[model samples]
Target: MNTQMTYTAFLDEQCLASGPLVDVATAIQQHANQSNATVLIFNDQTGKQIDLDISGSKQDIQQRYAEHPETVKKVGRPKLGVISREITLQQRHWDWLDQQSSSASAVIRKLIDKELNDPNSESNKMLAKQATDRFMSAMLGNMPNYEEATRALYQGNKEVFLDLIRDYPKDIYQHILKLSAYAF
Candidate 1:
């Protein structure tokens, strides 16, 4: 199964359809044909609006995929583009890391990977909030209760945010929920 993430499509500020990412372009096209509406596709995970060109024929798409053969490498360890960087650390922290592993570099890399995978990490939460803020600014800046919604979003008040966006178009409201899902 191709377990791609879901995406929501907005046509003329209303939710037209939402489904697997691959089908979003087709949905947008269909909605546009019916009403001549502007289409925007928002990724559910990242809260970023995506631009897709569904204008090419099947053969063209196939040819394009064929040209980018690196995308289909066999399942195994991929190439690591490692670069060296100087990191200054406190003596106690460096000592602790040295006690944990053979090499300080390995410990540092492991720590970075762990933090990156931790959704509840402070850095990750901040990133999620920033993404939510950007999405709100782009999609709801001119809405009926923009300031209150933005305040609620920053304060991590889901109920207030939901109530504020109650009158928004379905797609916008749902997209906000998806974007701020990690905020609280």
Candidate 2:
């Protein structure tokens, strides 16, 4: 539920629109009204296709797709954007945490932040590869040399991947390159 998340829409292999959900929804609604072309919308962050109800007026579409701020009551410091969740730890782990000067939550947050900030971390690299793969699978699944291009992607052979997809549609080629920039 990331409110700031952006989306990209494609009509066949041609990119149609890309922006916030509301803007994209309106664009899709207008395009859909004018043509019977099939438009696929994707969550940019996860490279996953999403279905949106765009059968309405522009205002209706915008209202329906716009992000509404949540009003849920948080257990921790709401002003600081802290949320509380339950976690189970082993007795030995709890004992060790209890001996630390900082709270266990603070210690855990630091550890997570450290990992998140490390762009070269294995987990981050894997996530980048997975995202690139997902996008490629969706957009280039039927294209020529798809299998070889995918292999090159996972193998971290940027040159080979680029060469394999060199003849793809310009928009798709650029988008694939952008999405897979970190994969290698």
Candidate 3:
């Protein structure tokens, strides 16, 4: 039986491997079964299964797997890369926040269900993109310290945001307080 396989279908580079031959064979077999292409596999004493090396972002790969369920299940597991965006707003921003996040399209919808349901909701902050944008814009044209600090946060630099949070803790505390009243 000849198990000679070429995974050029996934990548341009010539791949040399001596393991997980089964997984590749299985994946090919599944694709062949579903398509007009001819796929042949000979299961022998040498057992091997390795993931087919495909190059793409996690989100792109997940989308590919979603489109080809049978093929993915036959050979490999799709990796999930989720990003959680967190925002912190004050408890005093309820009226407007509630009205905004309640709408189905609002990205902050999940935060509202979790925080704004109870009358005595103590959530001082929220987690969302809108909140982050609002927070950044509010810091514009303020005192030099606040202006500089807020500028770094909105500039989309992770290191700057982290540093600002650490160096100017008082500013953050105050800014969040002011924005609390208008987080709609």
Best by lDDT: 2
How far off is residue 93 in model 3, in Å?
38
For TM-score, candidate 1 versus 2, the one ahead is 2
Point to the candidate with the largest TM-score: 2
lDDT of 1 at 114: 87
Write down the lDDT of every candidate, Cα atoms only.
Answer: 0.70, 0.81, 0.38
Model 2 lDDT per residue over 1-184, tens place: 1225788889988989988999999988888878999999888767788999987688888778887755787677876667788989999999988998999999888887787667667766666678777888898898899999989988888899899999999878877776676667
Q: After superposition, how far is residue 183 of candidate 3 from its true place, in Å?
A: 16
RMSD of 2: 3.0
For model 3, residues 1-184, the per-residue Cα lDDT tens digits are: 1223322122111122212443444454445445654332211121111243233544444454333324333322234322245567677665566667354225465665556544234332222223444444433334335555455544444455445554434544443433332222
Model 2: ten consecutive residues of lowest lDDT: 1-10
Error of 2 at 140 (Å): 1.5
Q: Could you tell me the lDDT of residue 98 within candidate 2?
A: 90
Q: Could you give the candidate ranking by TM-score, starting with the highest?
A: 2, 1, 3
Worst 10 residues of 1 by lDDT: 60-69
Candidate 1 lDDT, 1-184, residue by residue in tens: 1124677777667776777754666665555556765777776666678886656654543454232325445443334534566889899988898798468877887888888777777766666677677777778788789889888877878799789888888767777766676677
